[model samples]
Target: MHVPDGFIDAPTSAVAGVVAAGALAVSLRGARRELDERTAPLAGLVAAFIFAVQMLNFPVAAGTSGHLLGGALAAILVGPYTGVLCVSVVLLMQGVLFADGGLTALGVNITDMAVTTTVVAYAVFRALLSVLPRRRRAVTVASFVAALVSVPAAACVFTLVYAIGGTTDVPIGKVATAMIGVHVLIGVGEAVITALTVSAVVAVRPDLVHGARGLRQRLKLRVDGELVDVPAAAEPVAARTSRRTLWVTGLVTSLVLAGFVSFYASSSPDGLEKVAHDKGIDAGARPHTASGSPLAGYGVKDVADARLSGGLAGVIGVGVTVVAGSTVFWAVRRRRGTDVSPASTAGTGV
Candidate 1:
């Protein structure tokens, strides 16, 4: 649901921009604690993967479809703060490179799609994890529930934003009902994809999944009929594949999904698009500023072969997003390292 330019007026858009900026600033600071050698690179990969999977839109209702929002998937696989950054990176690439979303409405997209989904999904996921059995399957279950709730929550937020700043005359009540209704169906697809992806990663390397971090090899010993946590040294070395192998495999999977599988994605409008058309929510929609770019509309300019052009665009998008996201995360990690080094050196001097 990319809100094109003109859907919201200047003042509301500015306010949303401020909110998004603040959220991103907070995320950058918080991500330092979440990103490490292993997770920083994986976080970049997660962004690329989300970008790729989003291209493979699946049918929801008879005339509508939905794609992976990736908030819950990212939050479960990585950390929430990093997950927000991941989706934001993808949205940035989509707006500037693919012209998929509006540059003027970047804040709306970020606030609605990136921030709302990540925050809500992670909140629900953590709540579930706290109460549910601390098993690997429970993580997948939580991912499903989190994703299921996130999509509609995002739609609800969008409705509120529209109610306040919508450029059209649509009734707020009708817009909310339609947006939430269609997005609820879309939420099912989001849940399945998030759960399956989380399950697959957790299966291969539970240690790599941020949500699965402490759940693995949690040994409980019985002393005086009470169970106590085992020390880290007592835990056996996990039977795991090399990180390099997993990274390569994940990258290849993302490429395949975007370059080949995306061709088969449903051509129907997505839930938000359908709702917008039905409710006149996009009456004031303006053309994307980057409409003339070669990569605009997910196709190469002057390329007649639809499959080849789209595939190439998808591949290029994945490459660019990964590089961009990795650079951002690497810089953040390096800065974090620099900050820690001074403190460590001072402590050592004392």
Candidate 2:
């Protein structure tokens, strides 16, 4: 959930800002190990896709709706470090451009949404993979469970944050109960979306899905009544879909989802907003600093048609997010390239 300004006091928010910055710094280094030529570009696409899917909020309960948090989906598709960065990029774009999240509370949102969700989801995913059968289907199953748990985990984190720095008179117990209850329903939607998206990617390009990598079991050969591992090169290689084709397809899908399909999404308030309004958590909420932006509230200024204005905003968001994400990831990838020692490069005859 996007925490708005004034929900948390300046001191708490400032501490959260430090935490978010520290996490981002760590993720940037970890991402260097995760990103390569293939994954770096895909990382950007995943961010844009997450941004698009988040716009299509599905009804979770009476007057409550939920959307993709993207932590599990992104972690499964890419690596966890990059996944955190992906969601963070979407949060930044939404805050500064669409004014969806508050600028003052940016750190709180990042801490709750990006860091907490990614860490918890990826941990659960890895745990499930360790216990479950190592098959392609298992990846999708783990993704569902991971996504399901991450939403509630985020809710719990937000509750704790509010408990510490809440500006209103609401009881912490009530806030926790309501936040967790609604988000539990929201988690179901998150699970389904994550599983379906991961399954689709695993089907088309299992190579691109970081969680599904190494899923193919090694071939065993019986030699002299003893089983021997077959050489990896002896296995038949599957024809791969080109990265360009996959990237183009993903971008097109994101455009369709945000530009047109978003119009049909539920108009009801999301899980956090509903909980806040009902539980008096928004009593101290302040207006977003970017509320005056032309694209504030996901609509273009001076664009008369609701459909056209929202569509343009969505399209522009996707475009900007992709470019920004790609730039960051490419720079990370380049840094990784330059990390090579000149002696090593010389030894390799590069």
Candidate 3:
């Protein structure tokens, strides 16, 4: 959930900002090892897709809606470090451009949404993958389970944050129960979206999926009396297509979802909004600082047509997030290459 300004006191938000900054620093280094030629470009597209999908809020419970958090999907497709960065990019874009989340609560949103969900979901996904059969279907199943658990885990962590720095007087127990209950329903939607997205990518290009790496079925050979494990077969070179096709497909899909399909999203309040109203969590909420911007509230200013205004805002958001995310990842990848060149030269005495 995107915590609004004033929900948490200044000191706690500052602490959270420090924590988020530290995590981002560490993730940058880790991502250098994860981003490669095949996956680096897709990372930006993944972020843009997550932004678009988030705009399509699906109805969950009575008067409540939910959307894809994208942590699990991103982690499964790209690396966990990059996944965190991807979601952080989307949150930053939304806050600065559309005023969806508050500027002061950026750290809270990043900690609760980006860091917690990615870390928890990836951990669970790896653990399940270790125990389950190594197959495409198994990857999808693990993605589903990991996403389901991550949402509630983030919700619980948010409750803890509130208990420490809440600006309201509501009972912590009530808040916890309501947050967890509604988020559980939201988790199902998250799981379904994560599984489907992971499955689609894996089906088309398993090599591009970070979690699916080294997941091929092991070969078996007959020994003295029983079968023994052997190395897997090498993939055929002709089976692979240039990455341009995949990139174009993803971009088109994102454009369709945000430019058109988003118009049909439910108008009901999301899980967090409903809970905040019912549990008094928004008692101290302050107006977003960007409320006066032309594109504030996800509608273009001076645009009379509701559909056109919202559609333009969504498209712009997707475009901006993609460009920002891609620039960040490309720089990281180039730096990694630069770092490796020196080591190779030293090793070769060149």
Winner by lDDT: 2
- What tens-digit string does per-residue lDDT give for candidate 2 at 1-350? 88898889888999999999999999999999899999999999999999999999999889989998898888888899999999999999999999888898899998999999999999999999999988888998999999999999999999999988888889999999999999999999999999998998787788878898888546799999999989878865435677898899999999999999999999999988998999888999998999999999889999999999989989999999999999999999999999977977886768
Per-residue lDDT tens digits for candidate 1, residues 1-350, read 77788888888998999999999999999899899998888998999999999999999888999988888888888899999999999999999988887899999999999999999999999999999887888999999999999999999999999889989999999998998998999999999999999998888888889998877746789999999989977876445777788889989999999888999999999988898888887889999998888999888888899999999999999999999999999998988887786667785864
Candidate 3, residues 140-222: lDDT per residue as tens digits?
A: 99999999999999999889989999999989999999999999999999999999988888777888899998786555779
Worst 10 residues of 3 by lDDT: 231-240
Q: Any runs in candidate 2 off by more than 4 Å, and if so which? A: 217-240, 343-350
Error of 2 at 241 (Å): 1.5
Poorest lDDT segment (10 consecutive residues) of candidate 1: 232-241
TM-score of every candidate: 0.94, 0.94, 0.94
- Comparing 1 with 2 on lDDT, the higher-scoring candidate is 2
- Whole-model lDDT values for every prediction: 0.90, 0.91, 0.90
